[model samples]
Target: MTLKEATLVTGGSSGIGRAICTMLLEAGRTVVNLDYVLPQWSHPNLVNFQADLTDAAQTRERAQEIVSQYAITALVNNAGATRPGTIDTATIDDLDYVVALHLQASLILIQACLPALRACGNGRIVNMSSRAALGKPERVVYSATKAGLVGMTRTLAMELGGDGITVNAIGPGPIATELFRKSNPDGAPRTQKIIDSIIVKRLGTPEDVARATLFFLSPENSFITGQVLYVCGGVTLGTATL
Candidate 1:
């Protein structure tokens, strides 16, 4: 297998998505970053496609463009937006945007890229999920959308399995990113609490989530599909504190 095999990742401009893009590029893969914002980096193998993922037409067009321009073998749905607040306070527009970006966009892109993915033997698909989907009730809309991603992963795995494509998801817990800090003003303390409760007493880094994503997308991960692997420091073990 050559490094020219392309991996397309949405939300590659920043946060965990950026980390995932860098890792895949470093591993000698052609990386296509689909996002509304562009990253401050330059690489011949890194292809940037600026598109409003929430817009179905834009997503479909870009998906086609990526396949036409590269030998695409993987798709990573990581682009998402959040309007943090309780359901009562969350606006209709906010909820709509969340669903559009997190749920609808992924579905549209996968459908648009199916033919290309099927053509590339051993193709892979990964959805970036959240630990909040487990039991957290704070961001109800966000959690619901992420949980929907898990369902998409499983269904796609079944549908695309016969075509030699694998689908899986990764959930990150309390990652120390700028977004995380802004989302929780006292995030540091909260992160610390989560760390102390985890088997590994440290907040996870963007790289940690990226690495797990890479593992699932690797050629060796052919047998692993429909699995939501949480890259948190033992959060799934009931070790994490809210």
Candidate 2:
């Protein structure tokens, strides 16, 4: 099938990334998923491109190849991993890996996609950050990398605004996904504490984040840029006692 403009989403095989891909497809947009594995579902508008995002060289090469073949108008840097460790325990290797996946790869992909995005003249970029970036224990490296995305998003928004491109970020909190379950195992006291802390009294879903992401990527949101939207069920407002 032929498509005029396509959105490239990293880590689109699972979790929030998968939800974003599904939403974009439902909206009739061409989607190219860049992930280590193919998505569980398929659509005529969706194409899966496998790439190891932690490897900047591979990400750059693959991004170039994809943009060369498709008219890419949007990019979602949603690929991430949680390496839990405190400053006292975190190792250099841990920081490097997280930075590679979350920061370096995003820079490479953005550079590679610049031409195609510029051609669209109304390109959009949404970076996936996290509430951890604001401050969270046992997540020094992960938080650092995610926070870096916020700065990157803002800088890119300013730099690319002249081209009609908007750059923003989404910070999701306590989402009920396979990754969240793995990281915050069910029935754990810590998990219950987290659940009780949410003002909504519930964990968020991938669709919750997908909806926020789509809002930033929407053409009508041309005026919103360099902003971070937290889809955390009001968790960012601090723990509620109710």
Candidate 3:
């Protein structure tokens, strides 16, 4: 079946990015997966583009390729990297890589896609951030970059609202995925402790953040923009029940 709209998701080959792509595919949208790695899922309606998003020229070229070839009405900037560190131990290379991947690449892609999005008439942008931005010291670089993402979301909203575009962000906390497990080696024990701290009592799934993201990306969400809708399962509510 042909879809009325097409959505492009960066880093769509794995983890949260994969889940977002899957959700869009399930909703019957023509989806494009732009990443260096190919995801395990296959569908006739899905198009995969392999590229390093951190390379500005490559991102620009790929963006044009996607827009010229597909009807892209939505973009989900879900590509990013994370590293654990404190001010002292984090190297210059670490900061540069993190910022380039998490911030610069996202901006480059968005800039490249803006024209297509504006032409689509009802474009939507979803920037993937992290709940760690709220109050996490261990992840100073990651959190700061995510906080910058939120800033970009708001600014884009302001600039794009006049052109029928809505920009919003999603901050997910402690999601259960291969990357999460990889980040925390003692996955079960560490995850259990995290769950204990939450009201939900379970580590968040990729689907959780995907669902929250879909809502903002929905054609029905015209009224919302520049807002950080968190899918932390009450984690954002503070020392509340969760």
Backbone clash count, each prediction separately: 0, 0, 1
TM-score of each: 0.90, 0.94, 0.92
**Whole-model Cα lDDT per candidate?**
0.83, 0.91, 0.84
Model 1 over residues 172-209: C-alpha lDDT tens digits? Answer: 88787779777555546765666677678777899999
152: Cα error in model 1, Å: 0.7
Query: Is candidate 1 or 3 superior in lDDT?
Result: 3
> What's the C-alpha lDDT at position 157 in model 3?
99
* lDDT digits (tens) for residues 144-242 of candidate 2: 999999999999999999999999999999999997888689899988998999889999999999999999999888999999999998988853122
Error of 2 at 193 (Å): 1.5
Off by over 4 Å in 2: 1-3, 185-188, 238-242
RMSD for all candidates, in order, please.
Answer: 3.2, 2.9, 3.0
lDDT value for candidate 1? 0.83
* Candidates in descending TM-score order: 2, 3, 1
What TM-score should be assigned to candidate 3? 0.92
| TM-score, prediction 1 | 0.90
